[model samples]
Target chain A: MTTGVRRRLGVEERRQQLIGVALELFSRRSPDEVSIDEIASAAGISRPLVYHYFPGKLSLYEAALQRAADDLAARFVEPHEGPLGARLLRVMGRYFDFVDEHGPGFSALMRGGPAVPAGGTYAMSTVSTTNALIDSVRQAAYVQILSHLGVTDPPARLELVVRSWISLAESTALIWLDGRRIPRAELESQLVHDFAALASVSAAYDEEMGALLRRVFKEEPADGPFADLAGRLLTLAT
Target chain B: MTTGVRRRLGVEERRQQLIGVALELFSRRSPDEVSIDEIASAAGISRPLVYHYFPGKLSLYEAALQRAADDLAARFVEPHEGPLGARLLRVMGRYFDFVDEHGPGFSALMRGGPAVPAGGTYAMSTVSTTNALIDSVRQAAYVQILSHLGVTDPPARLELVVRSWISLAESTALIWLDGRRIPRAELESQLVHDFAALASVSAAYDEEMGALLRRVFKEEPADGPFADLAGRLLTLAT
Candidate 1:
């Protein structure tokens, strides 16, 4: 045991150190695969000391997940200039970059199990506040996102559409990570174009989306996606 | 042992009967949850008699899975009547109907497990022909699907789009099965529209898609989805 030279770290600092070590371990493998002994060894502390900071592996894993979520949420905080699609492209670019960086963790978080299992000794459902806290953070980012998309008074269907698009992006991102079946840049464009296409379709049935679509097109460039797509549709009639 | 009462049966017929019993049990819960004891009890036979037809649980499960796979492929066989999208809707309706009917088995099939894992004396991986048969059946359906979409002279991009659209349908189907978030009819329409939107976007960048899309439009209803979408796009410019 390396118990001879115990450093007198403050409670908060020691907790952070343990968490940092835990995050590194959790990032490599799923939480279920990781063990308490691994975290303690990596932190250069005994098992009891690791437990002192966090009650169990689930707690340690949650903290590490929070760290990654915070990093991802920060990437969406973008300047609202240029065309709406371009702005979203940058936001998505950042999102993809973060996914690329935290490949394993991003996948685990997206999978979100033991997190929302029907039964577990230390299930995420028992920790009600964790989900609440995460949802609050996520909803705030979606609010920022809706504003940039000019979706001020989003209809119920539009809200569902936006949320569904997010889920699609997550699933497609996972596939891209594994297969690179389509090029990364095309993947990004495909998602952007999908958003635009869905918005146009939504505009047909959703009153709020019509105004939102026009506003998006107003700021969009003459030769860009907005104009290009409209031209294609017009060509159908001519 | 019902040795005195047991009827004389052909080997293949007994094998089919045992597989049918196993499929019913598998259709209720996942393959992992099922046990040989339960299967024998359900079939009103002894455990050894259960083994007489199939060596173990894994073999039975694979046979059950193969049955479901064949059933699913059969559902996609729609007569090419009405619009292409309408034809696809009928195909998807059958698909979703199958999913609804065989909920647990459908999920397990999709999960495609090592459900009956190690030490299974009759493991499925050893039955190499089962996978080949399923894959060949699946490829034939994909070929049929590509033809229906007018994807003649398909480029690599078209193939990716076809395959990605399939994934989207699947992911969305799973979501529908769980949430019923959108009405099944709307889900079908949304998927159909998503395919059309993707095709148009693809047409712009792909020569093969450009030809394929026009051919699709030539056969499409003037006042149906094509006109409706073009009208919506024209609304944007004016």
Candidate 2:
């Protein structure tokens, strides 16, 4: 150890420095392409110093990933009390902004696997966090839409809505990232419109589907105003 | 060269053999995990002979991918003059059937992109082919839906329906692949129901949004429908 080198930084400062340097390197290269040696060299510290702060490269990566994930989770959850559409729009905006600002980190996370053996657990943990985030967002959006629609009961209904919305959002984001032929603005507009439509349509249809389904099971669809509709639904199923 | 030791095969037979062997390897490991050397050895041929049939590893992977893609496209594009819902069901059934039958090949294609960078151009081409097939299936489904609705006009309307429907299908499939939480039968049922709802809602909302937008441009209605809608949309703008 060179006695001339300063080593008086607090634990928090050292941890933060290591993460900041690691994130920069990780963003620039895939996990396999980056090494702890490179991280220590870039940070102007000894490899053992880096090891003292984190158990290993994998542990460092996992800590960094959890920090980034926590940031995203904070933006998407809670404060769910606004008008249904408004709240969802806010979450979506935050989501897209996060990806745009941090394209490299977002890309690695979205790509959903490790590029190195040391990164495998970190990569998988991030994926699990993402899935949970998606599920939570879906639920928030579903509750908002159902409240707007005035549907109080029917356990399966809200789950259906949330799953469907998540499906739409995730798929759109995946295709959009590939830089396909579609103009970016139009792609964004399309998603917004679809979300609005999904909410509005469920409001109208669920009521009808519920009533019609109940009657068809009774062998007694002989009376409701939408009796003909019920008959046709069964016919289509057959 | 002992004649008995090296039996010669024609170009077509050799190409087919190479694809079969590559696909087998892909089944065991994803495209990125498999090597050209393994493929050549498994096919009982020299490394150069494998290249003789296919330009490179990427081309061989693409060829194998294209075969499965073609089968899926054929099923999706197959004609059926029927009700919108029925036709969509048939197409959806075909899609799930294709995935079930060729789980590995479908998974590889669905997990699109040249994992090991034979280059981005190959990925771009694969994306285009995939987008085209998706578009085709979507148009067929749209035509059926519009026929059911008894609407025929300026082509833009049909294009809108097709685009939305394609997005719906693409999202549904991705979610289904990612989430094995739901039983297959239940997933299929929910898919049909949700898509039908989406199609109906999208149609109605488009018309409503278009009219409201026109009024905002022209007269700006008192306590206008778009007043709060703007703030809600601004939430989307970030």
Candidate 3:
């Protein structure tokens, strides 16, 4: 109110600004602690404008969750080029960045609870639908990850394996954040190594696992994440 | 009034029976849906007796969670015999058993939410605490796994890798339960391989990893869970 003339923002710009402000605030505090007024003030707009964009606090929170999920999901989406190991390393780097920025929000959503919302987009369901919310977000994220792993059309078993890897990454990321006991690069490499081991084991039954392993090995740089994996996997195949 | 014989049981047996009844009840539905009167009836006792043991519904829920966590943690503690891969497979078998018998209960605790109690044992904190519950359960179990792997005292980095592997197992178990798409044997073998792969990566930095890899290969039977691993590791060392 005191600041004389506010710069006019386009609908999209205003919507984005409001969501960004709300995201930052909610990242620090729960949805209940955040107020429409705070979001408006943060963006140099009025409370009504905030309401116009989000309708209510729950709606605002859902938009933020969608934005955060989209941002995190986007990290796993890299160009479908390069050796699988290098692509994974790059994706993990972006993942670490997201974990660092939204530690609380990420855990809250991942844990599946009442603190988050399920508005029209992200969590839009009532209390009974929390599982659905978690399932949708998790499944969608895994589809992207399995694709990056070159199992774009993952068989049910291969897809399960990739989903397991994703869960392991989530656990490792949380631990890594708390106890920087291990170097970031080492942690990333460890994950890549685990996936390699899974692929090797998967070969015992599924020809697809064997073929995928061969492709990754052929595509991998001679001296990169796959170097150590090479001797282990290559020896096993023969 | 219903039964002619009112059998008197010891305090501990009665308490155990009550917990078992409550667990069976809650395992089917979320904690919110179960009531004290029903739990008492299921145990063939009065509501006052149930209250006498648990004081309230929250206390009963907390006891069940601690029991489930202990039960799952207990699975990781097989007799420390046999090769590491065999030991892991055994433990994973027990883990899958826990996941199957107490699917929803295991998931509810693992997800870390308001539905469970934090009375004295676990998940009794804020969003930050959610990570702690996961970390606590994970570290405790990994300690056993590391012990079985001949890492009686795991170094900081190896410990981190084990934590990551445990996370992967948790994720795989969750996915496996949701979709019986993957065979139980396949899932177990994949986890064993992931740990083996992590060991190889660690060998690059630590002498212990090298020594253990040597031991696992040396002690491995002519034919066992890690036959595939032996081909790769043995060939590489030569």
Model 3 lDDT tens row, B1-238: 2233269989998888788888887777666567888788888888898888888876677667667667767777889777767887888888788888877766665654535432322222333344455556776797787676666777776776777777778878777777578787777776777676666666655666666667766677757666766565443333
Chain B TM-scores across candidates: 0.80, 0.63, 0.80
B1-238 in candidate 2: lDDT tens per residue? Answer: 1113257788898788778778767654557677788888888788887887887886787677656555656676645453344555566787777656655444554443335333332333443444455445456655555544445652443344444456565555555565444455544544554454443333333564344223322342223322222232223222
- Model 2 pairs in collision: none
Interface RMSD of structure candidate 3 (Å): 7.6
Which should have the higher DockQ, number 2 or number 3? 3
Winner of 1 and 3 under DockQ? 3
Clashing pairs in 1: none
DockQ of every candidate structure: 0.12, 0.08, 0.28
Worst lDDT 10-window in candidate 3 chain A: A117-126
Q: Which candidate has the top score in lDDT?
A: 3
Query: What is the model-wide C-alpha lDDT for candidate 3?
Result: 0.68
Model 2 agreement with the true structure over A173-235: per-residue lDDT tens digits:
555554543444444445554554443333333455445333322442344212332333333
Candidate 1 lDDT score relative to the true structure: 0.67
